[model samples]
Target: MAGVAGNQPLYICRNCKNPIALRSDLLSKAFIGKYGPAYMFSHAMNIIAGQKEDRKLITGAYSVADIYCCNCGEILGWKYLRAYEMQQKSKEGKFIIETAKIAKEY
Candidate 1:
């Protein structure tokens, strides 16, 4: 949070208003989640990653962990721990945050 520019927008937890990610860290808005549209981010903050598990996502099989808002305990999204396929390896270490779980704060 400290490195973010003062004017940069933020994505905050809808339930707790805790700063979750910076707009500059957003990588893509074309991702999908369990509920609906999701986003991929290069980095996230104020979050707690749950247990890692192997899940077959739309893209492929991956080791992911559900991320929660540290302040409110709301399930925000999942972080990609590992990608089984070579083509999907680029997604490793990235964050997938559901659009419905976060809001933009300008």
Candidate 2:
């Protein structure tokens, strides 16, 4: 894990409190996941991406990989592997982490 300055807030795994992503990397909070509300982030750390698979979501069809917390192995959300539609291509390489799986740290 990378060293985060004390002043910077970050998101941590709810299960194990493992540093997952920085608050500054958050892009949007208006996303929905398999469980419920989720957040979109430009980057994520301390995570493992599972196998890529095609899924039909509300937005469109996408190739995504389930993301897991490296420490506890809990399912956090998913990473956008590929976007089938050109319009959604920007989401490629982004991460969608369910709110229920993480907590904000100050």
Candidate 3:
């Protein structure tokens, strides 16, 4: 883990200094339909999301919020929730951070 100014490892937008998430709370990977692979985060800070658009995908079904960086308005990723009831739903609601849009901030 990398350390920031106060010993916290953070995930920040690559295009700006906007903090997106804490390293400790980030999940390794997530799958979002046509968007493909993304890093999963339980919580992301300093982000803005457009209106949630509900859609069904081959992987599963979800209502996703197109999330972006609050500082620079860069597309970060999506916050999704299972729009329909599932027999076995794991990650019901969570933020998916696109790996390419972020960098480890230390």
Q: What local distance difference test score does each model get?
A: 0.95, 0.95, 0.76
lDDT: worst 10-residue window of model 1: 1-10
Question: 1 or 3: which has the higher TM-score?
Answer: 1
Q: Write candidate 3's Cα lDDT for 3-91 as tens digits.
A: 33358889899998777898887876655424556787888888998897886756657787888899999988888766564752655
Model 2 spans > 4 angstroms off: none
**How many times do residue backbones clash in model 3?**
0
Please give, for residues 1-106, the per-residue lDDT of candidate 1 as tens digits.
4445487999999998899999999999999998999999999999999999999999999999999999999999999999999999999999999999999988
- In terms of TM-score, the best-performing candidate is 2
Best first by TM-score, ranked:
2, 1, 3
For all candidates, the clash counts are 0, 0, 0
- The 10 consecutive residues of candidate 3 with the worst lDDT sum are 28-37
Alpha carbon lDDT of residue 36, candidate 1?
A: 96
Candidate 2: tens digits of C-alpha lDDT, residues 1-106: 3366367889999999999999999999999999999999999999999999999999999999999999999999999999999999999999999999999988
User: In terms of TM-score, how similar is model 3 to the real structure?
Assistant: 0.81
Superior candidate under TM-score, 1 versus 2 = 2
In order of appearance, the predictions have TM-scores of 0.95, 0.95, 0.81
Q: Which residue runs of candidate 3 sit more than 4 Å off their true CA positions?
A: 1-5, 30-36, 85-88
